[model samples]
Target: MIDAANTYEALFVPALFQQWAPMVADAAKIESGDRVLDIACGTGVLAREAARRTGRSDRVAALDPNAGMLAVARSLAPGIDWQDGAAEALPFPDRSFDVVVCQFGLMFFSDRDKAVREMLRVMVPGGRCAVAVWDAIENAPAFAALVGLLDHVAGRPAGDALRAPFALGERQVLATLFKGAGANSINLTTCKGAARFSNMREFVEAELRGWLPVMGVVLPEPQIDRILAEAETILARYVTADGLAFDISAHLATCRRP
Candidate 1:
């Protein structure tokens, strides 16, 4: 898997995240002078967009548990405040932000309820919080194929995480959590979008290098090659001359702090 900042920035970001960050930011309703925090801000895509909307970097902060992710985030958007932290135990004062946004991060938190409460704690009354989570793995056919392949090859290590990101996809359950966190007027919306990779090979390469779940599985080269070859056929349906194009789904929930 790839580790360098440039490779991740150039390939992985555009392939999976770049297309979705703005959608999350827009739902947050970030405005000028608003202090925004992006929880689990992987490469700081949403945080950077918040900073741009605010016309100042200091007003935008990003937090994540992974040093590698924070490192890449810091290098790309050095102007913003990037903290090394987790979603459950955020290292910030209560009512510290005007908006809280998380992009495909809620499902990965160790304690999603605690994380939701923390997000509400950090936002001012009447402020907005927007969260995005992937829909069920089945809805994203490409990922379904990938995870199925991982399971077929390595039991379950990689496949588990691939499934975790889509765990909190149920609308009623998500809404209940937000309401319990003291957020009112919660609006949950499902969005279907295209996930594009430059090509099938690049898609495989990016997942091998950039996706933690995939890279964490330590298999011999030949075994890995075999897995990749198998995955190729499974994902072949999504590939075109331009690249791999397929419909992916996510749920975006927006709420106002009480």
Candidate 2:
């Protein structure tokens, strides 16, 4: 069986998450010497980008609750200080970082209000924070189709797992979360991005093998195969000469600590 985190880094990172790393970093306005913290760092795509832009790996720290994800992140970027932790309760001194970023992670936090509060709590008085979350399932036609496919083949749980990432898509919901956490000068922007996979099979497998299990909705191989077969026709509109491609969007929220 393929490791989920490894598959995520291999498939989802380049296809989905990588494009947002620089955008989130830019929203945070990371400078060469700025201390950065990446909450729910996953495979550390944003953390790695922050390290690259900041030009000081020692100044970059990333935290995630998953050991498997952290292990993959550490292997890929050893210079980063990878920690096992959750976003609701950050393991750091108050006002420790100059910039804080959470890319596509706000939706999964058990206590999003607390997590947002923790993000602001760890930043200096004037520190900046940027968070990225999928805009909405309906906004991305490819994923909307995938969700429909999962609902038909894998059941509601599997479809819901795929839908979970877009839970905070609304601009007001995102802005309110940070404001409730006492964040100041909140700014929200809708950033356009795209998801591309080698083919329909790879696109379906990335979610089946890499994402569903993490959400606790693993299907049998036969069911997975069935889904893949259906995906080719269901998601056919996204197929191109190069691969499966479609437009995707996310809301990026930037804020500051008073």
Candidate 3:
């Protein structure tokens, strides 16, 4: 069995999530000697970036509910503290971190408001928190088409699993979430990025093998083949000379603990 976390780090991170780490880290203004926490740190892409900016791995900690993900993160950056936890209930002393960042994680949190509150709860007064979430499904045409294809072929659960990441894409809804969580001086910015895969098949396979299983929606090999075949046609326009490339965007929400 190929570990989903390993696949996520190998395929999804480079294809999509890796580029946003710097943006989220910058949004939080991570500085040397500052303690940082990356909530829902899947494979710790942003957490690694935080460690780089802070200039000390000991000062950076990453937490994720999935132990497999944490295992991969720990292997990649053994110096940083890796914890197994969820966003709604973080396991740390209050005011433990100077900066907190979550890259492309806020949308899937079980209790988004409580998660934000927990993020604020762990930060020192005036500490920075930055979260990155994908923009609406419509903004990313390739994903939008994939969702439709999944809905048609694999059914609603499969499609919804892919769609879940974009649930909190709306700007007003995100701002309101932080406000309800009692975060101060909240700001939201949309950052544009790109998703690059070696080919259309690889793009589709990454989601099929790396993401959907984690969401509890697994398709049989035949269906996977069918989806891949259709995806090549559906997503043809995104193909480039080097590979497949498409525009991807995310909303970065930044705030401070009061």
Candidate 4:
């Protein structure tokens, strides 16, 4: 899993996550020497960037629920403090960080309300936080197509894993989530980017082995080829000899603690 994370950072980071991290960091106004915490920081992508912008004073920290992910995070970016934690019960003390950023992680928390409250609880008064959630699977065609193919071949469990992250896709749902947590001046914006891969096969391999959410689904050997065949055909239109590119959409919400 640690090795898988390395590949994930190399391959999927640019294709899926790299753009959003900076957007979140900028929105939160991360400055040099500012203490930053990245909640659910799988592999510390955002934390690492924030650390770069904040200089090498070790003011950056990352936390995640998975030990494997934390191990990978610690190895790749040892400068930041990496801790094992969940969003609903962050391990840090109250009002500890100047800014908090979560990229595509809030939807996976079991108790999102408590998780939002926890985000607020762990930040300094009026601290900024930026979060990005998939707008909708349908809005992101490649992922949606892959998920549909997986459901048809691998069953609903496989598809659900892919769909789960977009559970908070609705803007109102996200707004209410922050508002109910007493967040002030909440502003939600649509962030559009391209989910790029070298090819359809690259996309398949990454999703099967590198993507944390759908990584663990055990498929029969026969079904692996079956699913791939279908996905390739379904995704062919987006593919070129050079690679594949698909428009992806997500909601980036930024707010200040009340």
lDDT of 4 by residue, 61-97 (tens): 8888777778878878888999888898888899999
Candidate 4 segments exceeding 4 Å error: 212-215
lDDT of 2: 0.92
Which residue pairs show collisions in model 3? none
Per-residue CA lDDT of model 2 for 45-158, tens digit only, reads: 999999999999999999998888999999999999999999998999999999999998889999999999899889999899999999988899888898999999889999
| Candidate 1: residue 103 lDDT (0-100) | 93
List, residue by residue over 12-73, the lDDT tens digit for candidate 3.
99989988999998899999999999999988999999999999999999998887788899
TM-scores of the models, in the order given = 0.94, 0.98, 0.98, 0.95
Residue 110 lDDT in candidate 2: 95
Q: How much RMSD separates candidate 4 from the native structure?
A: 1.5
Global lDDT scores for all candidate models: 0.83, 0.92, 0.92, 0.85
Error of 2 at 28 (Å): 0.5
Give the Å shift of residue 138 in candidate 4: 1.3
Error of 2 at 243 (Å): 0.7
